[model samples]
Target: MITRIFPSVRRLHRRWFYGLMAMVMAVGIGLATPKPSQAGLLDLIFNGIQYIQLSNLSTQDEVRLGRRIDAQLKRQGVRIYNRDPQIVAYVDQIGQRLAAASARPDLPYTFQVVQDDSINAFATMGGFVYIHTGLMEEAANEAELAGVLAHEIGHIGGRHAVNQMRQIALAQGVAGALGVDQSALVNIGVQLALSLPNSRADEYDADQRGFRTMGQARYAQSGLVSFMRKLDERSGARPEFLSTHPDPGNRVENLEAMLESEGNPNATDGLNNSAYQSKISSL
Candidate 1:
């Protein structure tokens, strides 16, 4: 064993020791090398990728979006206002009543009844709402009109339209989206700033809010039920509004059930029916 332990053995041991040292250095270098982190990595792939600007839109932006769309819609075509001054007054009267009870009554809300025989109605952004003459004719009375108007009021007061703008701006980004030119992005924003397309959750919320307003203003909730029933019964000549706001099947049912618990209270009408008839007749 002593003879075997030669200087050559020492040389081999030194070589093996150096090999082990080299292996340790390799492992240390591999451990120290940095790997990619999980955060702020998306920016590398998407150029300035942005998201919904719900909280980003200013009040001015909201109002501007509303006004822009209002103009575009008017340019597309101004709806025929019933010729009868009384009809205009009647709609304004009920609208004011409902607006006063709305969450954002300070907004300059205007309600107009268009001389069209379609069971339809819609609320534009920026506190403008339109009701079809057909819808008014279909309504049993002023309370029903008020109920319908109240629902629209709920939509506006909920800021659903402005919220829509935020959604579009977010999805579209502060830059551009949906193949729209940068110049037309604002236009698309305005057009998309609708009230109803605001999610089923928003619709349900608006429905409840409007119902409460109807109750508070002493408008007959059964008017809402009757109106919904009419909408549900509608078979022919559906309006564009119908295309957007599908019949909330259980909406009226739920409203009736709610009223049942609240004892079906009395309603005081602020409508000028005689004037409405005269105005509509002229149109």
Candidate 2:
């Protein structure tokens, strides 16, 4: 009677263990590469958790993350320029054109001006992109302004922020991520918005994407190349642009190569300085 009862207990334990593993797999957590020592069900549940792949994150999750980051940026004193309807409308128009030409044309892209005088622009997750007033003031023409917007949009299209956050979460040891950590998400967003620069590869990829978008949108393909050359010429002690983007020299080189591949076409068919200037004069 004792032996028969022991066999029944062992069978119960086996069934319960397999059921737990099946549940873990169903939840998409057990797909991770298991550790050699983590053969047992309990160890699999508790040990050596790995990073969640970016593919696991949905587009809605990305938009939510962007909204959180955008909120944090607003709270951190990042001013939004809304006083000039003309400026806002014009920027939005150009941004829409670029987005239409982008790979992810259906994304709800938003382009806004920041009141800062720094020559920098950044894109968080989703389709949010910001350009500083100083960068606008320095742009030679409408094409140049559109070029910057296209570049920022490229960052969004590439989902750079989401990729960055995945790495950030992994580094922070937050395993089994399902995108519900509000505090950690906010902190990561702040870091991305205020301090972290995208990798050089990311910067180059964005540049290429922007270049293609500008070409397809009938804007001057060389506009970004010219902008990078100007930045390289006048790069003094760390400028805001350099702080968040790749070096001007490398960017210029890459853009020049791209331009060479696609020979010069007619320049941008967009607004002239007078049109853009009159609109921005309100600032």
Top model number, lDDT: 2
Give me the candidate number with maximum TM-score. 2
lDDT of 2 by residue, 1-283 (tens): 4545588899999999999999988767644654465455446346642223454767776776677778889988999988788888888898999899998897878788999888888888878899888888888778888888989888888888777887887788764434335557667867886789989988998999999999888988777888778888884566588788867798899899989887447546554778767667777
Please list the C-alpha lDDT of all candidates, in the order they appear. Answer: 0.67, 0.79
Put down candidate 1 lDDT per residue, 1-283, tens digits, no spaces: 4566789899999999999999999988865663454233344335543232445555554455556666676666657575677778878888888888788777777677776776677776668888888777766667777888988888887877666655675576554322223234446544643333557666666777787788778777767766776776668766555565655677767767776876335654434566445444543
Kindly give the number of clashing pairs for every candidate.
2, 0
* True-structure lDDT of candidate 1: 0.67
* Candidate 2 Cα outliers beyond 4 Å, as residue runs: 1-55, 177-180, 263-267
